[model samples]
Target: MSQRVVLGLSGGVDSAVAAYMLKKQGYDVICVFMRNWDSQLNNDILGNPTNNDPVCSQEMDYNDAKAVADALGLELKRVDFIKEYWDHVFTYFLDEYGKGRTPNPDILCNKEIKFKAFLQYAEELDADYIATGHYARVEHRDGDDVMLRGVDGNKDQTYFLCQLNQHQLKKSLFPIGELTKPEVRQIAHDLHLPVADKKDSTGICFIGERDFREFLKNYIPAKPGKIVDYATKKVIGEHQGIMYYTIGQRRGLEIGGKGGPWFVIGKEYDQNILYVASGDSNQWLLSDEALITGVNWISSTKPEGDFDCTAKFRYRQKDNDVSIRFINEDTIYVTFKKPIKAVTPGQAAVFYDGEVCLGGGTIDKVYHNNKELEYL
Candidate 1:
């Protein structure tokens, strides 16, 4: 009997190709389209409809997904995860921003929804494994599943999947992990897939390409605040809200008619003050170390106590050599080998040893010298 693999088939080139590849491998492929967001259910806090788009993007995506599944001769299933996404991913997203911290919802979405909820759905289908189009690879060795970076360095997505655990990795498959973006597109083209020439989706997951501030205002009430200079402590300008702005953000300050351009250095949550410093690479933005919490170790070979590895504080960032000291079972204090700029709280600090992913944790606090940057 052929192994049955349930695949998450987003209406995009990558996932379309993933579905095709799984079928070619002789697996009984079942394609599922996950509907995780609905603008109708997401009204403003004041009970007014926020989105007014004439055409719904999610519906269009489902149409494309159905076309792909039909062309590939696979069974397509549509599932609603809107409530689960709200409770698990979106709530945490709003809470982190409320605390004046920049959170990566993509990380949490993978941990809670794709691998957890969707994996459960796949299991109920009596499948041997679940697959996606993520550009990452899993290696089974010595009775443990190990995640490795995708072969395409530029398109590697292991950073987002860092929060996945042993069981998730064991049952998961990344069909396009070894292929580059162009290669995946080419395969789709050859297969005459409808999404072969479709543009890749960008911006926040499910939120689509809407104005970020406007979309956020639908959920969190915006409180306008004052923007201050960090070095002089002088009021420079006014801001929409501290929650909308993030550390190291340079655009949309609207503080025009200035001596020069300025970048957000920190945020005072209690005071509702947004702090800025002149110049893009301000010294005030640099940090020497950070305190990480909610750590998850995915590697089969776990390191005890203090250890050395390379880590990326944000996605697409080059790895940096770091020293890690275990503070607790789920926490660590990491000292960067070099002074890294803008190590913001609530973002992930994903660690890697060569190509193998060693798991990671969310950044809780940042420090320069020995003093904590409590303002952020």
Candidate 2:
């Protein structure tokens, strides 16, 4: 009998192609459509698709996943993770935002919703392994297991997946890690999958299909604020609210005095003050080292001593060389070889060594010995 691999089909080209590849490799495949959110959230008129930005085509997505599974000649199962998402992801998102901290809910969603839920579901179905379309590699490191980056540098998703513990990586399978996004699309095209041309999913998972602010409006009550340059204390613009904005944002600021270009430097939640500054100010916006807290080592043994590796502080950030020094059981200090721009708080800083994912943690604070941004 062939090994059976239960796959998570997310109604996208990547997951569809993953199903095909696993079947072709002689694994007895069963594709599962993870219903992380209920459809009623979309069909409800008050919570209509137009009202919320994240609630896109749930019916279409569920159908697409089902159709792909049928076409691949596999049994399809749907698991509802609504309760888990609410308890773990949504609560964290709202709490972090409430505290003026920008949390990466996607990371929490992966940790609490998809992998954790799907793995349990797969075990109940007597499967050998659970698989998904993430662009990261999982390998046996020295007898223990670890995850690494994908072969395609441009589309690597290990950053979002850094929170996975050793046990999770031990059983996870990322079918598209060895291939690039274009290559995965090609595979889907070759397989004649329905989602061959389907656009990749973006933004916070399961909060689909709503204008971000409009969707957020339902959750977080808005508060308007003034945009001022911290250096000059001159009110150059007015913002919708500090909650809607993010660090390093350039557009929609509505600032004048275009001496250069102003970007979001920081926000003062208590005072309702949004700080704007020239985009080119390295001293105010950039930093070399940051203290990352809540570290998770996918390996059983945490790395000790000064270790050199590449890390990404936020999603879409290019890899940069860094020296990571373990500070304690729960923290580490990462010194970038060169100053990295906008090392934002409440983001994950994932370290890597080629395809092997070292580990990662939450960014808590940035520091410069004598001359640092006084406000931060």
Q: Tell me how far the alpha carbon of residue 242 in candidate 2 is from the true structure, in angstroms, after superposition.
A: 1.2
Model 2 agreement with the true structure over 1-376: per-residue lDDT tens digits: 9988999988989889888889888998988888776545533523554434443576689899988988888888887887787778887787778656688988888888777887898989898889998888888565788787888988888888888887788778888889999999988888788889999887678767557777676667687878888879998778887777778888888766555488887877788888888846675778888989988877787778998989988888778999999889879998889888888787789888766777788888886653545444
What TM-score against the true fold does each predicted structure earn? 0.96, 0.92
Query: What is the total number of backbone clashes in candidate 1?
Result: 0
Against the true structure, candidate 1 reaches a TM-score of 0.96
Highest TM-score: which candidate? 1
CA RMSD, predictions in order: 1.7, 2.8
Give the alpha carbon lDDT tens digit for every residue of 1-376 in model 1: 9999999998988999999999999999999999998777755423776555333488899999999999999999999898899889989999988888889999999999899999999999998999999999999766878999999999999999999999999899999999999999899989999999999888777667777787787777799999998888999899999988878888999987775488898898889999988865647788899999999989555678779999999999999999998777889899999999888998999999899998999999999899998876
**Model 1 ranges off by over 4 Å:** 44-56
lDDT, candidate 1, at 101:
83
* Clash list (residue pairs), candidate 1: none
